[model samples]
Every structure is written in C-alpha cells, then in structure tokens.
Target: MSRTLIITNDFPPRSGGIESFVHELARRRPEGSVVVYCSSPAGSDDAADPHFDLRQPFPVVRDAARVLLPSPRVAARARSIAALEDCDSVLYGAAAPLGLLAGGLRGRVRRQVALTHGHETGWSALPGASTALRRIGDTTDTVTYLGRYTRRLLSRALSPAAAVRMRRLAPGVDVERFRPGAGGGEIRARHGLGGRPVVVCVSRLVPRKGQDTLIRAWPRVLADVPDAALLVVGDGPYGPRLRSAAAGMESVVFTGPVPRAELPAHHDAGDVFAMPCRTRRGGLDVEGLGMVYLEASATGLPVVAGDSGGAPDAVLEGETGRVVDGSRPGPVARALIGLLRDPDRAAQMGARGREWVARTWSWEHTAERLDGLLGAPGRADA
Candidate 1:
C-alpha cells in the first residue's frame, strides 16, 4: 500500500465547498494511506485546525496560502512532508501553487494528480497560472474536474497530448449523515416555520450565488403563497444588497451563518432548496458542481438551481430538481411558487432526489474511484 501526500490551499476549519471536498477525500482513504498539507483558516492559528490532533490518526500539516493558491511556504513544507512520509503519490486540491509545486517534483513523486474546479480553469487570465495548469495537465497522472463543464473549461488550457490526461471526479456528500428525517422538524420549529411551506437557500451571500435574484423573485412567490417562508442561510459581503432587495418582506428570514453540524437539519427543514446561481463578478465567478445541491437532494429536498455553469451536473432536471435561469425574476419566481404550491409533487421530487443521491453520489463511492485512479495497480490513466 503506497502512501499519498495531499497538498491543498483549503481545508477545515475553513468552511467552503473545496474544504469539505478535500476533507472527505482524505477521510475515507485507508489509515496511514494519506497525509494532508493545508492552510489554517484566516485569523486562526494552525493549531486550531480541528483535524490536526494526534488522536485523529492522520497527520495534517498547516501552512499559509495566497488568494488564488498556497504561498511558497506551503509548497516548501509540502515537499518536506512528502519526503518525511515517503509518499508515493501527490494530489493537489487545486491547480495552482500545489500544482506548480508538483511540477518541480516529477521524478520525486510517483503519481501526481490535480483537481480543477471552475475558477482556476481559465488559463489565460492569472499571470503564470496557465503554466501551472499546463504543468499539471502535461505531467500529472490525472487532472480531475468537478463537473463536465469544468472539464471542458480546463481542456482549453491543455494541449492535444495534455487533454488526454483529463479526468472527471465530482465531490460527493455523506448520504447517511444528510438523509431525510434528521431533525428537520426541529429546525422548522426553531425558525418559526410551523405549518408554512419553506424554501431554503444555503450559500455565501454573493453576486454569483444570485441571492439577490432569489429575493427579487420572492415578491411574486409571496403574492401566490402568503404562508410561504424564504430562509436565506449563510452570509457574505453581498448580504446588505440581498437584504435591501428583500426589504419589508416579513416572511423572508436570514439566519446568517449556521454551524456545520446543524446543516443537515437546515436542509431537511426546507420543502425546496433554491439557489439561482449564475456567472457574476463580470462572468468570472461560477458555480462548479454545487455540492450543496447534492447535500440538499441527499436530504430529500428538491432543489432549484441556476442554469449557468456546472450546476446541471448536481441537479437532475425534473428528476430530482429544476435548473432555472437565475437572472430573470419570472422564471425564478415560477419555479419556487410551483414547488411550494404542489406539496405532493414536491414530495415526489424530494423522494426521487434522495434516491438519485444514494444511487449516484456518496463519499465512500467517490473515494473508491479516487483510490483506483490514484493508487490502483496496473491502472495506466496517463
């Protein structure tokens, strides 16, 4: 059993999509099979990372990172850890810094893999980022993408030979943990959503997430179903704008930021999960395989996602949920109202979503695929 070194800029106690994804990836692997190198959450000391405890059984080394990638300090420490662990393989959570680092260790690391999400897929923008991505695509054993669209985006960065190395590996949810009937009623009661239909949106309050668009559509939703409640969970810089858009709407509730352990209940509390995500911040920021959509679906809540980016990959249109145009209030309003009004139909959709999640996505299954790609003998992916 060969050991692996996973270098990443993001990991918990940093709460984001990538942080959780990488944590699950390392968690499900065999004991002693993986060692992690990651950055501490902003303002927190490295010792504060929850998984760094010796009793946890895995070695988690904390370092620093830049906005786009881990700093040089992260790369230097990662190299030291690779040598110390005698790791046979190296996996970068994203393309930059670590991917750039992996390039310098071609002969040192036996197998190298880089996972590309949406933001870093654009090779032409960031200075030297294209070279970093190219190195991973050209030299690494595999370059995995979170969704089909993300893969297509990354393929643009690769040459003909490098394109052959591209692979698909989406983030998965803990189905057992986020299943239906897990204290959902408690959350509903806690939020004073007793007997009222609930629509929940869980994401950072950002322009790309389209919380403002959802708020704009809520007026139409309110006119039709007066008892309907819109719960906007999570907070960010764009929150003030969202709140302003939703001004004087009594039924619209902003829970701000909830704890992670309490998230499953939040998902289950909703009759429908809605986040009309679109390309924003001048069309650069995008949603790539929204794991939140999967989590909501896994909780047996029908989702209403955006049509842009790779959101379609997580949402099975009409099967588990609907992907609507996030820009227009008409389409967004219609989707929410339809789901809120048709309880039986919503329930049916939620049930299908639960089934789809169980059949299609799980951390265990995702880990198995990752294991095969990263360490399986006789598997010549590159």
Candidate 2:
C-alpha cells in the first residue's frame, strides 16, 4: 500500500475512548504514511503535537456534529485527501459518523476499513443511520470490531457475506506508560489511603459504566473489610446522583475527573480495579471491550469487571481479574472483598496481568497488526 487516510469523527484534544483509540492508531503507524481527517482540535491550542502533525498530515478538521443536508462533508473531505495523497487504504475510526459518511464512497477506495466499538449499531437513533451503517458494513473491505462481543452483535445485524469479512481487534495498552510497580505511593499518600486496600473505579460516572452499582456494593465490602476504600476517579453527568448515593459514606471518595496523563498513579494506589458496566434493562448499550480494565492490569493491579459486553475479551478471568455480575451488590462486593482479603493473591494477579499485557496487549503489537493489514497482506486471500 502506498499510503493510508484515517477519517474519524473522533480525535484529540477531545477526550473519550474513541479519541484515545484514534490517537494510538495514528501515532503507531509508520511515519509519513498516513493522513487524518478528523474533528477539529488540531485547530485549537490543546492540539499542539507538532511532531505528530509532521508525521501524519492533518488535512481536514470539520465539525463532526454538522451534517450536510444530504451529502456528508466529512466523507467528501477524506476522499479528497486520499486522492491527493494517493492513499491505497482508508480507515474510519468508528462505523458510525465517519463510516456512515463514507457509505457512498466505499467503492472508490481500494481497502475500506471501518471499526466498530459498541452500541452505535442501534443506539444512534438517527433517521436512516442504521441503513447507512449496514451499507458501511457490507461495502467496506473489513469491518473491525473491538472484540468478540461487538463482532458477534454486528455480524448478526448484517448479511452473512458481509459478516464473514468482519475482523476483531482488541484495543491496545501502553505498557511502558502503565507498567506494574510504578510510583503510586504519592497518590495513596495524597488521598490519605496509606496501606488501605483501595478499589479504584477510574472511568466516567455513567450508568452504563456502573459506578452506582459499585457505590451500592461498597457497604457490603466495608462490612467484610472495614479498612478498605473505594476511590471513584472520574466524573460524568451522573455526578449528582452518584454523590447522593455515596453521601455520608466516609469510605467513598469522588475525585471528580482526573486527567488521562495522571491516571496511572491512581491505578497504582489501588489494590483492585473495578468497573461493573451495566446495560439498561432491555438495551444493547454497555461496555465495548473495557480498555480501562487493561490499563488497570498494566499498572499491576487486579481487576473486577462486568461479565457483559466485550469487556470479557479484555480481561482474563481467574488470572488477571474476576468477571462477575457487576449490576448486583452481592457479586461485586464479594469480588472486591475476596481480592482485598488476600494481598498476596491480589499482588500475584496483578503481576500476572502486567506480564500478560506485556506479551499480548502492547500498542506496538496492535499497530504492527494493522500495518500488516494495510501493507503487504501477503496471503492470497488478503
């Protein structure tokens, strides 16, 4: 392949799972081999990574929310960039938005790739959005799902032929950044949690993230281990409600939103990591391969994640962490208390997690895999 153009509705200095994912992908690609058409922040003061700009040309930065009356300007801009750069492959960060925008131009690109994380298959609620996504899946050369759970769901939603072309890519972790045995003592000291087994929930406080469930289960954990602490490290729209639920509870501390840069130490301060992601009673929206679980594990922390969604693929049960019914107080509390009780066991698990991540989940590995797909792809089928 000559070059690649990654068109995305996600980018930095905007913060979210997708933004981080896109940045990782862009950063890992071989220098000067890719161009990006993404949401404008490359235009803002926050987006001052000049070295990245020198490598991956930032051609178009459009308001992702603004859709044309009929045609998508984002897609049009990406096509124009691909033409100018003579790109051989095109990558869309998400199957919705950018992928939907590229629906009509699928045939124009040689290797059209769309990545799906979760929920967007049916959660968009936009007129004709589902149809557009189907077109995206069927027409794109490969539809990359974040994990088996997402691939399974999306495969069911499209034609069998299109489903056969589906691929799965688990998001990667920066092992160098979030390694085991880092200097996490300062965070612990600052929080006054010296030597207390901390259960950290380092995600946005959304209902889907299941922070509330963790809060409800805390009392039971405290009953089992009175000195244990729950460090809720993120903030979202559910802030008021979560604070209300944890009100008057001395063990529960909400640190609001911590920057992504400062997250590793917070993970270091914890003995066990948790995010009991829960879906609404009858909805498909839930965790789509929880990357934070991998981050926690990379920091040499034991994990406790929900059994639902693509999260299971990211975590190895009975090895690095435990997967339980996070929606329920009993399971969540039991999982936390069990890990907190035996520091030796938890430390072993964390060590295993770090080792496993170093072997299997590095950003370099994911980048190499993607580069192969976009590059030589030597197999006859490829």
Candidate 3:
C-alpha cells in the first residue's frame, strides 16, 4: 500500500482543535500507511514525553524545534522524509507557513493536501500572508476549509483555480464518547454543583472565544435563574482576565484545563453549553466552526453559539440553539437566561442537536471523506 507523509506542527501531546483534528484523521488512516513528521510539543526541549511517539501505531518523527516552520532546514527535512519513507502523498496539518513547503515537495510527492483551521482565516486578510496563502493553494493539490465563513475569506486570497478546488473538511464529533449520559454526575458532584442549572463553556479561555462575555453575562443569568451555575473549562493565556471578569461570583467555577478524557463529562455536566465567541482584529481573528458547539450538541446539551464567522454554521437556529451576538452581555445573557429558565424547551433543543450531530458531524463521516480525498489522484498522476 502507498504511504503518506503527515507533515504538521500541530499534533499531540499539544492540545487544541487543530491538533485534535489532525491527530484524529492521521490515526484513523490504515495502519502503516501514515507516517507523521511534526515538531516537538511546546516546551521542554527534545526530551519531552518520550513515549508519545512510541505509543502511536505508525512511525512519528519529531523535529528538534518546538515550532516547525517552512524554513529551508525544515523544508529540506520534510522533503528528505517524504523521499526516505517513499510517501506518495504529503498532508500538511495546518496550511499557512507549513503549507508553503508544498512548493518544495511538488514533483516528489504525488499528492499534497493542506488543512486549514481558524488561524488561516487571519492569514487570508493580510497582504504578504495572502500572497503566501495563494501560493500554498497553487502548489497543493487541495486546500481544505473548515466552513463557509473560512471558505469565503480564503477564496479571495487564492487563485481562481485554487478557489474552485477548495473543499469543506470541518471537524467531527465522536458520537459514542460524547453522547448523553457520559458521566456528568461525577463532574457536577465534584464541582459542588448539586442540582443546580449549570451552563458549561468548554474552550481555551481566550479573548476571541468570549469567555469574558460569558462571565459578564453570568450576573444577568443569575438574576433570572438564581440556582444557575457557570462552569468555565480549559486554560489559556486569557485565564487571568476571565477570572478577573468573574470575581465575586460564587456560582462561577473554573476547572482550569482538565484532561482530554474528562471533557465529555464536563459537557455532560452542563444543562446548556455556550461559547459567546466574537471576531476580533477586524475579521482576522474568528471562529472556524466552533467544534465545541458540535461536541456539546453531541453530548445532548442545548448550545448558545456566537454569531461570529462560521460559528453560526454549527447551529440550526431554533431547531438546535440560539445564535447570540457574542460581543454584548445583554443578548448573551438573555439567551442563556431563556434557555436556563425553560427546562422542557432546552431538553427538546438538546435532543434535536444530538440527532443533528449524529446525522451530520460524526467522525466516521469525516474520516471517510478524508480517505477518499487522499485516495484521489493528484497532478503528478494526471
């Protein structure tokens, strides 16, 4: 069987939406058919988790650098790996600077595919970065986008042919792992949230993710539903700011980055899931699809999504949940309050959301799509 070189900066034991997406897709590929070439996880030098690579089914080659760029040395190493492994294709985990390596790997690799997430949307707007993005689109056989919002912006930066070739490859949820009754009781009991109407937001505590907005809106939600508790999960640079935003609120709890295995239970603990994400830096910083919304939906929780970029794409409006203006505390508060106040309505929406996720956002479906894409012939074959 022909093999593929998975070239990426994003991979586990670093955690994020893009990292998870890439790792999931690569792991799902046929055994021995994939070989990963990724940079070392963010800190701790080359000595970082020695068993991370050993645990993988396929070979995982780690670069010494903490972050891999398309610099001459990095590109040279990628090309050498592709050649050494006899890889028929090259898969770039995040398109942008790393995808720039596609130009160097062209004739050597039969197929080259680059996956883009939220950050690429920012790159599409800048002058120099936009040109580089166009080049990446030009060199790679395909450039996959997360949603319509990203596609629309990226299309402007890509050549007509590249734009025409752009395909939707959004993240997917694991139905079995994230389904209803996935152990929310323990999470609630641990957090001292006994019988309270809980609203959970699972994401990196960040400015754009609107955790601050949710914090600001918590007071209004409490005013309407006094028993309601706000659960903020995950940690980031914005944690301090978010904590400050929630000061003096006893009902507000921060889990501060739980293990990945515990995330599903965190979602399960919430009666309603909300992330009032807003686009910042003009349109540059935005949500690509808000996979957490889909994950929340899969866990049978009614979502309150922000109307930023492609985040609205994850919701079915009245059928699943409300899409609120993430910037303002009033609309976000009202939305959360409305959902918290009505148990029957929220349950109905949650049920509908789970159904929608099972039908449209399963990891099986995404893996199949990626399998077909990888199997498709490229320019070299043509």
Candidate 4:
C-alpha cells in the first residue's frame, strides 16, 4: 500500500461543499494510508478541537494560518510532510494557489493531482490568477473538474498538456443515508405540515442561491396552490434579509441550520427540492455542480435547479426535474406549481431521479474514479 499526502485548505470543522468533499474523499482512503496538511479555521487556535485530529483514521497536521497560500513556507512544510510520510502521491484538495506547490514538490512525490471547483472557473478569467493556473497545470500530473461548464472555462487557462489531462471527479451522494422514508414523517408532523404540499430549498441563505427569489415567488405559488408551503433550510449571512423578504407569509418557514443527520429527513419532507442559484459578480461566483441537488435526488425528490455554472449538470432536465433562470421568480414559481399540482408526475420524476442517483451518483462510482486518478489499488470493500 502506498502512502498519500492530502494538501488542502478545505477540511472538516470548516463547513462548505468543498470542505465536505475533501473530507469524504480523504476518510475513504485506506486506514493509515493518508496524512492531511490543512490550515486552521478562521478565528480559531490550535485548541479549536483537540480531538478532531485524534478521531481521524490518519494523521492531520494543522497550520496556524486560517488560509494556506502557496508561499515558500507552505511549500517547504508540504515537502517536509511528504518526505517524512514517504508519500508516493500528493492530492491537492483545490487546484488554485495551492496547486502551485506542485512545482516545489515534483521530486518529492511520484504523482500529483489537483482538483478544481466552481471558483477555479472564475480564477481562470483573472489576470494574475490565470497565470498561476497555467503554472499549476504545467506542473501537476492531473487536474480534475466538476463538470463540463467548469471544464470549458478552466481549459482556456491551462496549458495544452494539462488541458488534455483534465478529468471529471464530481461529488457523490450516500444513497443509504438519503433515501425515501428517512424519518420524513416525524419531521412533517413536528412542523405541523401534515400532508401539505411542501417544496424544500436546502443551501446557504445567500443571494446567489436564490432563496430570496423563492421568497419573492411565494405569493404566486400561494395564488396557484394556497395550501403549498416553502421550506428554506440552512443558515448564512443572508438569513436576515431572507427573513424580512418572507415576512407576513406563514407559508414560508426557515429551519435555520439543521444538523447534518437531519438533512435527509428534511429532503424527504418535501415533494420537490429547489435552489434557483444564479451566477454573480460577472461569473466570479458560481455553483460547482450543486451536490445538494444530487442528495435531494437520491432521497427520491425531483429537483428544480438554477442554470448557473454546473448546477444544471446535477439535474436531468425534464426527466428528473426542471432548470430555470434563478434570477426570474416567475419561472421558478411555475416550476414549483407544476410539480405541486400533479402528484403523479412529481412522483414519477422523483422515481427517475432516485434511479439516476443510484446508477450514476453513488459514492462507489466516485471512489472508483478517484482511485484511478491516484493510481490507488482497489479495496475489496470499497
């Protein structure tokens, strides 16, 4: 078994899609075969969570900085960790900035793989960042992209050699954890939503995520289906504004940051899942394949995704769900109304989504592709 060094700024105790993605992949590697080098979360010290590292199956070395840059100091530390662990491969959790360490660690590791998410697409269009991306491409063995939309943007910033080496490594959902009948009954009853039509939006309460659009469109949804309810999940800086927008509307309920274990049940409580996310800041901020859409689909719920970046990639338009212009509340309302009005059609779409997730979005398939990228041997139980 070969050892691997996982160099990343994203990791557990810090919350976000990338953080979860990196942590899941690292934990799945063979026990004791990986060593993680990550930075501490912002506003926290080494004592943030003393037992966090000990609970991990592999060693986790934390840097004092809140964010790790690809400076000489970080490079030297990464090289030291790689050499000390005798790691044969280096996997960068995110390509930009940190991927620049590839050049410094070339001789220390046999293979290097950097993963690119939605933000990298924006970085590819910047001046200095674009040049850094090109250098990262020139040095790393492989750079993984989440979907075609992101790949198209990043390809223009990478060298010809690296462009050809780009691969897809999308996030996968745990089917067993997020499935139909996963405690949804209790959730609905507890919330006094007994058998009422519910549409759920699970994501940070940010403007780009279109929770505000959903709130703006709620009146139309109520006009069409007066008994319909909108369930907004998760928390963020935009919560106050969203609450204000949804005020005086009892149909709109905000569940303010549910625990991770309760997420599947929340999904199950809804007839449809929606997050009309839109690209903002002239494409600088965008969705990176929308893992929440896949998780909702895995839970036997049809999705309504915004056509931003790779968000649509997670939905099989017309088959499993519908994609709409997240900025327009009219279309979003219509989509939700259509699904809510026709129970049979919604159920059929949900069934197709569940099947799609089982066949294409399983963690097994993602783990297999990851193994191939890292040249890792197959685990009988994986």
TM per candidate: 0.93, 0.90, 0.96, 0.96
Candidate 2 accuracy as TM-score = 0.90
In angstroms, how far off is 43's CA in candidate 1? 2.2
Query: At residue 213, what lDDT does model 3 achieve?
Result: 90
Q: How should the candidates be ordered by TM-score, best one leading?
A: 3, 4, 1, 2
Selected candidate, larger TM-score, 2 vs 4: 4
- Candidate 4's clash total is 0
| Tens digits of per-residue lDDT for model 4, 7-99 | 999997777899889998988888878999999876542355556778989999999988999999999999999989889999999998799
lDDT of 2: 0.77
List model 2 lDDT by residue over 125-214, tens digit each: 344665666777777777777776776667666667777777665578888789765667988888888988799989987888889999
lDDT of 1: 0.80
Q: Summing lDDT over every window of 10 consecutive residues in candidate 2, give the lowest-scoring window.
A: 61-70
lDDT per prediction? 0.80, 0.77, 0.90, 0.90
Instruction: List, residue by residue over 1-382, the lDDT tens digit for candidate 1.
Output: 6888888877776778887888888888899898987665676524455445354558877654433354566556676888889988988887754677766667777898887777875552454866667766777778787777877777777666777766678888888889898778998888788978999998888888888888888889989998899999898899888888788988999989888888898888889999999876554677877888999999999999997788999988998889999888899999999988898998899999888888878777788778877865333222
lDDT of 2 at 379: 30
How many collisions per candidate?
0, 0, 0, 0
